[model samples]
Target: MDETVKTPVRSFDIHDILKCLPHRYPFLLVDRIIEAHGDQSCIGIKNVTMNEPQFMGHFPGHPVMPGVLLIEGMAQTAGAFCIQAQERAPDAPPPLIYFMTIDKAKFRKPVVPGDRVEFHIERTNRRRNMWWFKGRALVDGQCVCEAEFSAMLVDTPTA
Candidate 1:
């Protein structure tokens, strides 16, 4: 009998994103991670659509992807980065990524339905359990949003 073993991928699809991050459904902003270089940086993708819950109320007729959600997407991307950066056993529990800080956030363009947003994140600094990253959300090679953010990786708590 011959069997093929699928090598574990460092880059993430939606399923892998689900496994790495705790978010789901309307909350899971990142659709896929197209690129990741060790723990240094990554690029996450989000396919925006009219069905997203936020579109219902953000503006009745004009649907603009919220800036906060863009930040959230970037944070989720960072979460995946934190997971990929660490060396963990196959059965090891996944760590929870927590937002520490956000600075220098600016929205230069509006992201709307049908826009495929690419979030590019680069690690700026790492100390102890926290990591600082610079992120930019782009559509069609134009910057939509940019921010500097930090997050901490923590072991899941036991009850």
Candidate 2:
């Protein structure tokens, strides 16, 4: 017999991120961005689970979500903000923004299975095509990870 259980995924559901970004399974961290405040800030959601591949080696009996993956989730959420910002502008043209630097990074609590990581980020600064952002990952309203990062929005040559 073949069977599968499909859990409801709205806050942690949006799969369009796979198409919008280059990240894939295991690396594809973010589940959805439920709220956005223009180019100012955004809120993304990630649902942690025991089924995640990293759980196997991160710890055999005890599983803990890696801080780096959490940061990636935050940065990716910022990338989405940049993408949405560009989409809002008529003359911005098609492009991709690459993360350049992350500073003042901090990891607080341990994120385990069944925890919903709410990623929040705010635009700190922007100049020309370069953008700077402050990001944080939270669980139950407590900070888990935070970082300050910069990115460049580049225009690709017409194909």
Candidate 3:
């Protein structure tokens, strides 16, 4: 009998997101996943707020979401996709997704507190344990940031 079991694709709430990725408060960026396609794409939501640590120094009094964090949020969305993919095989080892490279990054507008950022990420390529994705962050349907990035899925190192 086969020991491997494939995990299915599904939506994620904050609790679910926590289970899929290893990030926590202050660094955990994604608020929830609205939809996801098997190893293909994911759409996630982020609720920005003035209380977020970055805003305290990123530019006090004029809170703006850092471009890097926007990219990070996009990356997190991709990470969730990878986690869901691994679920497809129950016996498959849980993999840690690492940001490998980022390119073609563009920030079109400043993201401010109270903005609901939507990260739209789609797989571009996958070779072995490495995967490439194109991502975009939008607010009110307007693009605020976009980039192409790659990540590697590997077995978590023993402590």
Candidate 4:
């Protein structure tokens, strides 16, 4: 008889995300993460609002979440997942994750205000402290954007 151990799915709220990532407001894109399975995959939610700073200059009359920001959101979501999945010493500082590459990025539709954008990310590969992910930004269950990206995790420098 063979018994397989399964990793339990985890979820992260804004506070938990704050602990995992270093991003703050005006840049922090993911509002929450759900169905996270030990960095294998996770779905991140971002609520687009008219009050966002980008709307002020992105367009004078119309407000649309920029495609670049969408990609950044995907990267942030993946970064948070990588951090949360790792094991570290209790006193160790959170690792700093840097965006390394964005590839095969395609924008299908413009993300607008009031849209609840969900970033679905799946890990494709991982080497040492680097990880690669395939991500899709969806709105109301429809795909709005997709991309493949990579990030590297580095330890924080001691003061």
**Which number leads on lDDT?**
4
How many backbone collisions does model 2 have?
A: 0
Cα displacement (Å) at residue 75, model 3: 0.3
Question: What stretches of model 4 exceed 4 Å from their correct place?
Answer: 1-4
lDDT by residue (tens digit), candidate 2, 65-150: 99989988998888765676665456534466688998999999999999999999889999989999999999999999999999
Q: How well is each residue in 68-136 modelled by candidate 4, as lDDT tens digits?
A: 999999999999988999999877888999999999999999999989999999999999999999999
TM-scores, each model vs. reference: 0.92, 0.82, 0.89, 0.96
Q: Rate the local accuracy (lDDT) of all candidates.
A: 0.90, 0.81, 0.90, 0.93
Q: Give the 10-residue window scoring lowest on summed lDDT in candidate 1.
A: 1-10
For residue 63, what is the lDDT in candidate 3? 90
lDDT of 3 by residue, 1-159 (tens): 988765455788998777678899989999999888778888999999989999889898899999999999999999986787765466544678899999999999999999999999999999998999999999999999999999998777777
Clashes of each: 0, 0, 4, 0
Candidate 1, residues 9-123, lDDT tens digits: the string is: 3678898887788888979999999988778888999999999999999777999999999999999998887797788897777889999999999999999999999999999
Model 2 error, position 106 (Å) = 0.9
Query: What would the TM-score be for candidate 3 when compared with the true structure?
Result: 0.89
Best by TM-score: 4
Error of 4 at 123 (Å): 0.3
- In the order shown, what is each candidate's alpha-carbon RMSD? 5.9, 10.4, 5.3, 1.3
Q: Is candidate 2 or candidate 4 better by TM-score?
A: 4
